[model samples]
Target chain A: MARVIRTIGWTLIVLGVVVLLYVVYLLWFTGFETQREQRDLADEWSLTVPDDPIDHDREVDREAPEEDDEPVDVGDAYAALWFERDGEPIVSDDVIYVVEGVDLPTLRRGPGHYPESDRPGGEGNFAIAGHRTTYGAPFWSLDVLEPGDTIHVIDRQGREWVYAYVEQRIVQPTELWVVGEDPLGSGAPMITLTTCHPRYSDAQRLIAWGELLDDPIESTAEGGERDEIPES
Target chain B: MADNDAPNGDDPGPRADPDGGGRGGIPRWVKAILLLVVIAVAVVVLFTTVFPWVEERTQDPTMGTMLTPWLAYLRF
Candidate 1:
């Protein structure tokens, strides 16, 4: 009967509409949740890391947060990451807070630090994972970064660790070795950033590796101009 | 039976009220269309606003993450 046909047609239309709206939610609306969380994390970072710069003489004897390094809670924000090209910031006009874990909930908040890896500015590998296409897509421009670009990580004490981009690789999600010890076999303090490969899909992972520069630029307590931190 | 079909050769179904609609109210088709529209709007609002708002607090596994395996299967 026409009524039966009409009912089926209406059901299909409703289902189609839901599917379309969900796609929109995935791509667009989800970012709102991330942005709000990022804001809260930024505020928390400022409160925890004071604006006052460390005294140079006292700082020389003090290492980059490793001496008193404590275990970070899984979902806690620990550091801020920003990108630069030839010393000019490439993206992240607002620094992206790196959460402590790569689990689903933690990553939905921001770039997540692999708990197995060393903390930012520590020895060995400091690995992080981020969403590239949704939840604010903090690493959306990961592919655009070229070797020799810079990634600056500001730790809890406001000390800036500058890393020079070394290489980028696209690998299967199962390639756990990419974040393992000395992934590049360089035997240096390195950083790894991972995100789902092929924008809008997660069939693979895009990894970018960076090595810490010889010296880290310490942010002055003033902390007003984060980018102006002179290379020490 | 032939009288059930209008001059345009279409059946509007039996009219209980005999005023072209049931109980002298909106046509059944119009009501059905309205219901569909309401459902579509609710779905859109739930996905866009209500769900995202709740997700910010609940931190539950997101639909995107849960559907990844299915999406990969569909693509392959």
Candidate 2:
């Protein structure tokens, strides 16, 4: 009986240690690793790109649906986000910094852009997702985001597009429409960010939607190019 | 019946085993083989069952598509 009790006790101890390590990895270690990845991406983006404008005007090609096109590959990053903090108290850093594409590997790096969502500087809803309570918990303070907080997405050409947080709502994990809605009919440019809700629980989704502060203007196709990135 | 066979009616030794076959328990080599077989089956199941499921989920960048909800139950 004592042997059996000892075995069960040891198993529990091992399990407890494993859980603690996992939390540590999710909270601290993963954040540190992602910081390294972001720095590498920043370095890569600063180099190996040239100045050539790429046209993105959808008006000229009305017959073809531009919105349905796939987002950039998981490997290629387009923008790094910088949140304005002094103007807002909720921001943990000046940069809540996220790389392009919200795939698992990409998200492990930082907040990921939902490729199906509208691109930055577009007429429809542009969406991004981040981990709410783990793996750096980029959006852990999402509950703190309210009206007036600014989320910035920098274009490949060094032009920064700004969006202002309007409101945030908590919805169940089953609430899929928030990310699927088409705002093109409204003729307003919007940005939506979704993360796990209630912190440490996946029972809900915390969605913070924002409208573009910058007026959508004609692009010279520069946002698509691999070059022309400013180091600063 | 085996309890009556103990030398001094004190230490039951191998006879105390429930099976009463004089085989106290599974042999050490048999236990090792069982462990190896269990590990091999687990690896096979993971590759054949879990690996593909994960691949399909990651193809889309959306949050719903990326999450393996069942795996989130432990939150560990």
Candidate 3:
């Protein structure tokens, strides 16, 4: 009887240890995979996006999609997402490439854009989903983001859309309204970032909302040859 | 019966263990610890290697995929 009890106890201990190791993998090892994917995606983005300097005098119709705003294939990287704090880059040289789909596999590579949502700087909500605790954990500090913080997105044509943080909401996972076309109900150009809430749990979602600012810097394409354009 | 010849008494010397001396005459507690260590190593391999290989095939990035039906609830 004593031996049987000891065996049972050891079995439980082994199970506990397994759970701990999985948590470790989720928190640490998974980031390596995401970082590698992001590096490749970043390289592709740099090569594809024009290097032309910001054309300050160019006119941009915020409500209309540009001719170059071709739909990005799902799982493919097309734009670079950057966070700014105090007018400086937040993640320090890390430019997270935003993939075209919010599916699990695409998100594992980096932040994913919701297919039904509007494009960056478009007249509706441009929603994105990202991981908070695994697979690069790009939104790991999302909950701490305060209003007025800025998020910048650079597209293939070198158009930079700047968005200012507005509010945050913790909602049930079933709350699909957060990603709706007019989440703010004003038909304004906005951004919504969704991630698992409360760290280490997916019971709910944490949403960070932002509105597109008017100062969009446009970089012109020079002869469609990236090599000919000088990098600033 | 042979019981009368051997005499039933508390003789703590080396005796035949029907459960098999696979225990190698080691103490029960020591064996239990060794068993736990082996299990821990297996668990590490399963998480660090086996599960990853399975994930690669399934293209399922979440760990919940391994647990399946039971862990389907763990998905976002």
* Top model number, lDDT: 1
Docking class of 2: incorrect
Tell me the deviation in Å of residue A224 in model 2: 41
Model 3, which residues run further than 4 Å from truth? Answer: A1-9, A52-67, A91-93, A216-232, B1-76
lDDT of 1 at A44: 79
lDDT of every model, 2 decimals? 0.70, 0.58, 0.68
User: Ten consecutive residues with minimal summed lDDT in candidate 2 chain A?
Assistant: A53-62
Candidate 1: lDDT over CA atoms?
0.70
Per-prediction fnat values? Answer: 0.05, 0.09, 0.09
DockQ of model 1, rounded to 2 decimals? 0.12
Model 2 Cα shift for residue A15 (angstroms): 5.0
Q: What share of the true interface contacts does candidate 2 keep?
A: 0.09
Q: Candidate 1 or 2, higher TM-score?
A: 1
User: How does residue A9 of candidate 3 score in lDDT?
Assistant: 82
- Per-residue error (Å), model 1, residue A148: 2.0
Per-model TM against the reference: 0.72, 0.63, 0.67
Kindly give the stretch of ten consecutive residues in candidate 1 chain A with the minimal lDDT sum: A223-232
Strongest candidate by TM-score: 1
